[model samples]
Target: MQEFFMDYGLWLLVGLLVIIALVFLLSGRRKAEQPIEPAVSAEAAPPPAPVPFVDPIIAAPVAAASVVAEPVVVEPVAPAEPVVEPVVEAPEPAPAAPAPAPVEPAPAPVAVVPAVAVVADGEDDLLRLKGVGPKLKALLIDLGITRYAQIAAWNDADIATIDAKLGSFKGRPVRDQWVDQAKYLAAGDIAGFEAKYGKV
Candidate 1:
């Protein structure tokens, strides 16, 4: 009976140890499954107090230096005064004497001649002569030659003087045989004029 008691007691001790281990595992598992609570922070600490602002007083010289940093404008200078020369007085001129009275010129001598002389019984048509047109007739009348006889009597000197005065009609006298035509016409010989110089 003593030997049987010892063997059974060992088996009983092992069974008790297994039951205690199961009890410890079950307690740890229950603790892990529970939710954890967060810790609260101490008071929220108030924000640090703001620092007081202060203005600095600057010196007048330092302020003036800042203003002087701007550009400066310079005005143009005025020109110098011009030099003046001394004025001199001119000498006075002598007084002029009274001018002498102008001398009167003597009257020119006047020759007495008749206004009209008997050169022809009456004026004839000088234009009847060859080369004598209305313009030539006017030029001849201006020279006091309204008669055919005057043209017939024209010498070389008279022809030259009259031709020079004729201007555009200068060579007409000699060119058309005006003197020959005048001679026949002055004598009232139309036949002679036509015979020597074709039809008048």
Candidate 2:
């Protein structure tokens, strides 16, 4: 530090004195450059610029960003919850009037037995009839219905008896018209049987 001051101290002091003198001269010239107010006019005219220190570029967005703003945080509020109602079961209907005393029901009538000739006690080819396969023929044989006359004599009672024993083939006797088919077959009416049932 002592060496720096010794080398440049005098030169620095001379430069400072020159700068101060130049500033003094410039200030005096600036004061002289202003026009003298006329004594004739009572009012003073306004200068073109009132504030020379403030620059037009100072109004830019870069100058406005000098101060940092702190953001305000807010907690969200929740909406009110909806209310739920309880469920109830419906009641049974009310009864009022009494029903009429039930009548003594008569016995159901049985189907009339056809007057077919009682055939000899020999097993006929039950399979020759429509819908009577070997399994049914065996079932019929087991039910003591080996002859065509046996099937031809079937009234409601006989049909009910056989239907009770037929298992899966129960309703077949009535639905297939086995009694009617057997009547034609028992009468030895080939033309009638073939015409009624398809080519028995």
What tens digits encode model 2's per-residue C-alpha lDDT throughout 1-200?
99899779988999999999999999999999999976755576764776557665966667678768889898888977878666676776677678988998887655333333446654678898888889999977766677787788777887886787788887998889999998998899989999989886
Which portions of model 1 show Cα errors greater than 4 Å? 1-121
TM-score of each: 0.40, 0.41
What is the clash tally of candidate 1?
0
Q: Please tell me which predicted candidate would have the highest lDDT against the true structure.
A: 2
| Model 2 quality (TM-score) | 0.41
In model 1, the clashing pairs are none
